[model samples]
Target: MRNKSRKIYSMLFLLLFLWGVLWEAESVYAANWGSVELTAEEAVLMDADTGAVLFEKNAEEKGYPASITKVLTALVVLEHTSPDEQVSFSHDAVYNVDRGSSNAQIEAGDVLTVNDCLHALLLKSANEAANALAEHVAGSREAFAEMMNEKAKELGCTGSHFQNPSGLFSEEQYTTAKDMGLIAIAAFHNEEFMKIEKDLRYTLSGLQRLPEGNILYMEHKMMLPESRFYDSRVVAGKTGYTRDSGNTLLTLAKEGDRRLVTVVLKDKSPYHYSDTSAMLNLGFQETEKQSLEDAEGFLEKIRAELVEKGTLTEETKLHFSSKVMLTLPKGETQEGISYLLLEEEAEKKEISAAEAKASDSGMPDAKDSALPHIVFLLDGRKVGEANLYREQNIRVMLSEASPKTKAAFFAVTISGFTIMIAIAVFLFGGGALYGAKNFADERKRRKKWKDRRKKRLEEMKISEEEFRILLEKRKKEKKN
Candidate 1:
């Protein structure tokens, strides 16, 4: 009987422990599970300022980014060149549909400013624009790719490696949702980048003519009116889709003082737009709740501490009076009750006397003269009252420049001009003008040689009969 009782007690204890463990597990699952449904392979919502992860779901999983890789491409271009700088397309930028997957319609010889190219790349997901901008910035796509990797390291994007400026498919070129979010946050800070990504409709001026002679227009995919996730607060974002990576989105949203960075990658569901929208909404709501809870706790602590100390006294009251009981005329001054002590009368009298004397003397109050007095003190002495008016016009002369200073300034200016001239000659004269001249000379030489051959033919004046006889004689000599 004793052994059976001991066995029953042990079983009851074991059951209770298992139940407790199960309960805790369920509680944890409940805390994490929200109303929003997420289909992304990897997703993250992060604080832009602190880089704090508010929520994450498989955020470290690697996935294809598709055209979203152009975000890094845009970042590299913006770092290297200004927006207004012109970029001319090359043969490399020509989209050849036969050569794998090429999306952009940009062709060789088309010209666009770097700013405009960036717009097409980010908003329209133009692969040709991405390549053109990359080549323009770093002289080659490979070098630009190296720069992108270097920048990734600098930005602490450990999970990303860029093989191309255009996010073409390669197993080696992959990034986690968290790393993409970080990159998006960094890119969003630049005004030019933000402008291009958020712009719904951008008319690219110089897309190459099609076979049909019609010009092509690049349109923003994310800015489509039919997109359910569209919000004015979304300053910038990139959207990407591929067979491997279903759909990916990186968005920056600002509402009031709150800024959110959201990244969703490899979503398997058909309603990607709605899924992202719900996730972002839930993230914002959760963050707000957390912030309010923190604020309330802090305020409660402060209130408690203040009440415990003498800082907040019960008699320190707010009196309320009805408007009807108060016979106050609009714009009329009323003298309220003044609290004073008899012991402080002398000090008050002195202050009032000084103020009255200033008023009677038609002089500005002491407070008005505070800045001037401070300036005078800074200058090591007070200027006379009359000189106060002149102080506005008085410019403090800097001491005479030393001989070394004069020499340095002259040297710097001369060197600046020298560098400027060298750059102008190398860029304009050596590259364009010299090439043009060389081409012209070659053409002239070719033309002259052709003229000489024609003159020789005319001088020879060989008739058709003579030419036929010479050809027969040559054929007979070869047979012998």
Candidate 2:
């Protein structure tokens, strides 16, 4: 009876322990799951300052980007034409848009300033305004579209293409949340763009088209001060919709110093705002920003190396052309961040013998002094990059000259039998060290040359075998 009781107790203890372990495992699984549930089919939460993705779901999936096209349209227009530039509406610009679609009702031959057009474009969601602005900037809608596509490519948008300036329904026109995010980030950098986006209302008083002042109210419901969904953190945003494309929104908001850009596409009514709010909250709760310049010790170490190598001098003014921002989870240390300094390829130019001599004598041409890019990675994924520049010219300093040159100078100064014997021993004994150093340097030089050759071949769209044959032929010609 006693043995049976003890066995029963042991069984109970083991079962309880097993149940506790299972419960803990379930808790951990729940913790790993994302904190927010969104209704959008494609969405992304990005750090506005750093361009770092905080959360994403099907961000690369292409979908119709209705009025959001105007955001890019406005950006491109602002890049080419000033805000005060006069825009004349043509018959095509006014009548090309669908009659039932939102329009500013400007007649052909009527004119308005670019600033007024942008107000109508953004606030009233006017299709005619977009068309008029496009024509004014590029002389024709087709050429303006080419500029848009080029701008998209420059912004690293691979999954997006623009067939028209306005976000009208087109089979070929589509964009992804990821691509729009990049475009929005670039646009936000423009002060005039943000200023236009942040307006609650815009009234165009002196228009050449309209006799009475046109009062335009904000079209974005969530951005309205009286709306229940209105968030004070929201700085600027754009909204879009079409029959084929469901409601889409690209919004920028800031909480404290942490700014977030949210893109939600193909979402049901009101859900885009709800989904964006949830994601923005999660981003603020989970992430913190760290400036790359704060890595003082790390930067000092690099600066010391640059100074020792004669790449820079103490008197040389180092002005960082770019500033890096790292966004990471709150409470997580910066141990995961890594950096790589990559020099940009300088343009190769042919110079006369006199010019070459001048270049070799501590006076490098502009083509010879390309700046370097500092790339930052978090958890092995690229987070951000910045350029490093120096105001002073690059040259070797006397104090930091290579040891071999100093030794050669010393050998030349001492000329005698004993000195000759010393030199012979030095040459033979130092051969091993010298050979190893030269081998390492040669490998670096070869790698750089190979990289340049590979880049050239890629640009020319040539095969490796063809490039090799061409290189050998050039070498033979040079030898001759």
Candidate 3:
């Protein structure tokens, strides 16, 4: 009997040690968003549409963009010139580049269409082509660089200054990770730019062809299937390197209906690629995106309250100003999502219709902001929010617009709403989230999921006492 007691005590001690160790580990794992490690000096991960930052480290600090500036070059060229327009390479364009830099070997007076030059500029990072295209668009490289800077400012970039189109080292030429990410989002959203950059290989048919049959291949290896850093999710990207700049990378990836942009700047080779991959993983794995359209209960509550308060009219059709998305921890669920209407009586009337949810949940936890907007919450934290708009704005914009405006509006609308959102989800925090990817048949009765967890716990030699509560929550949820 004494030996049996000792063995039982030893087992309990082991379980306690395991539990303590796991708890500590989980805290650290989520300490810095799964401790997203990166060697890049500056990096950013963001939603392409809303520009919500998912991850960052010195993202606003200025760093040399190197050849990644070509993405902006491509954007400017697309905006100002047509693909069929012919561009004759001037003597200055052909020879006025940093010697030993990338070039397509085009001779002065060689004429190529803007489309071919773009392929060369993006795929080959050809310095001469960059200058040639710039000269064609704005009459001189200096003029084109000015155009580039103006466009960058217009795109909401605060820490960017452009002096050259080829991204050749210039003392004043620098951009922040945040600025580059915004530029990437704009460039990739354009259909013409998307088509040109997505091509894996292009043989320039320009009159002054390179060494005859030489082909240009995309420098970004992540999009190349055979590269070790290849990620199938990467739809478009750019790569840059220079002694001063180290390395720079910009990547845009799509998973399901979500679009993510990642920028890593001023890092060593391979790590630049690796850092981008890590940021992409961080965004896709660490966060769950919830769309406002699914929150019918919250929407109705706001509508009724607004009507009652005379803030809205009975004929005032309300919808999210845009298709707003809220990103939260992967372990969160739809019901955990709460809101506070920013109003004079907001403190008195917390709309916690779900039980004492109103009074219990500390609403208006956000910093001072504009009034008359709904502030969204999750687990007592402000995740994101949106303002209500009269529905007629969309109709008026669509109806009174010209044919071109209407077509563009429809395209933008479709592009924005292409993805679906879901109810809030909050799972027990672990290094990973265990939310079901499919909800069919209520996760197929959840039996297999439970069995899998049971087997994992058994393998660890854990008893019902340790993780039973965690597993039992699911059982109780299913019963409800």
Candidate 4:
């Protein structure tokens, strides 16, 4: 009877231990999203500020971008051309798209400004508007495609190529989900593009070419407030689909000041939205926004380096530029973050259209290029960066001339006086010019007198007190 009771008690203890282990495992699994299923063939979620990869699935695999290509189209157009510039549609642009496809209902003779065309290009997914803007800005579709590829390289996209302004399916055109995320990040930072991307409706300047009010409407229905997939946090987005590519979506959302860009490629009808939503929710829950402002720790680090190097005074207050922000996993310390000073002026995570254009053309402004930049790297990758500036009380002493400079000035003055006196005596004497011999002797005597005066002035250097006393005496004499 005693052995039987002991066996039963041991069995119960073993069961309880196993259950505890299983529960702990489940919690960790949930944190890692091991059970979160995704239907997209390729997708990526990235933090806009830190460029941290929160989650991704086959994100680097190349796939068709479809109409998402227009984001790049609008980006390039906004950079190279002004909003008021006019674009005229040619017969080729009007009829070149795949038959039974999307368009802004433009005819061969239709004309619109660059701004209006952008509204049509992005909001209406107007293939015709894309072609017309491309030709107007770069003079041909091939040239515009090259510009797109060049811009893609500048954004650090490795798996992408462009064949046309509009993402009409082509055998040569391809992009990865991660690459689209990069492109979306660039577009999200653009002020003009963001303004156009969020508008549910717009009245184009080409009112005659548009509907009753010359208005263009968005076709991304999911962005509508009443839609089932509508997310209030979504600031801007674009959607695309083709028979071969299936569905593609790109969106930028923010819970607060922390922004995230999510992209999904080769997905079904509702999965694109679901995948994007899942990634966004998980990202917000897992990551924390860390601002690198004038924290005492950071300031101290900067000051220590400056102090140890014996270059800057301890009083030189240090501050980071307000433009940079960091993203990290929740409850994590900044122990892993490291920094290095950059020799060249680094580009900002966000830049204006003019600055983007200027940078692309290899001509950043002089003032921007001169600031000292500190790039923060995490896990050997640049996670955040900003300019480091020193604020100090500049004690500007009145510039005092050195003894050598004073001596030089005094000698020049004495020489000039001697020459002027000789010239005045000769000119005002009312007599003929003296013989060359006599004039030469006079010059020698004047030169000797000037030299003696210079030597005496050099030997009789006065202290600051003596100089002040003499100056006061001169003022009194002048007053009397």
Number of the top-ranking candidate, with lDDT as the measure:
3
Candidate 3 stretches greater than 4 Å from native: 1-32, 206-211, 293-318, 333-480
Between prediction 1 and prediction 3, which has the larger TM-score?
A: 3
Query: Global lDDT of each model?
Result: 0.63, 0.78, 0.79, 0.78
* Decoy 2 TM-score against native: 0.66
Tell me the spans in candidate 1 whose CA falls farther than 4 Å from its real position.
1-35, 96-104, 207-222, 226-229, 289-480
Clashing pairs in 4: none
At residue 223, what lDDT does model 3 achieve? 92
Q: 57, model 4: CA deviation in Å?
A: 1.7
Candidate 1: clashing pairs of residues: none
* TM-score versus the correct structure, for each prediction: 0.53, 0.66, 0.62, 0.63
lDDT of 4: 0.78
Q: What is the lDDT of residue 71 in candidate 1?
A: 85
lDDT of 4 by residue, 1-480 (tens): 999999999999999999999999875542222224689999988888777666779988989999999999999999998888878889998898999887877778877888889988888888989999999989999999999998998886989999998998997999999899989989878999998877889876544455454567776665788788888888888889898888998888988778999999999998889988888888888777777544567657866976676434666667765656766667656666777765433333224424555433433233322334676766554556666765655331111223454566668889999999887877766433455567889999999997986676568885556767988999999999
lDDT per residue as tens, model 1, 1-480 = 999999999999999999999999875542232345687778877656445455678888888887778888888888899989998888877562226553556679988888778877876677888888888998888899999998876665878889889887779789998888879878867777877665566666656664433232323233455654456566677777777877877777776766777888888544555666666676566544111113234334433443465333332221111111111112212222111112233234345545665333533232222211001110111111111111221111111223454556668889999999988887687667777888999999999997986777678997556767988999999999
Best by TM-score: 2
Residue-by-residue lDDT tens digits, candidate 3, 1-480: 999999999999999999999999875543233448899999988877555677888989989999989999999999999999998999899888888888876789888899989988988898889999999999989999999998897676889999999999988999999999889989868999989977999886544555465588988999999999889999888888889999899898999887889998999988988898888888888876877647666677777887797655555456666767787667655555678786643332333222343443432222111126676765454456676655445554454345665767778777666532122223334312445444555667688888887899899889768777767898999999
Better of 1 and 2 by lDDT: 2
Better of 3 and 4 by TM-score: 4
lDDT of 2 by residue, 225-338 (tens): 899888888888888988888999988887887778889989888998899889888888877787774555556555666678665677655555655677776765666577
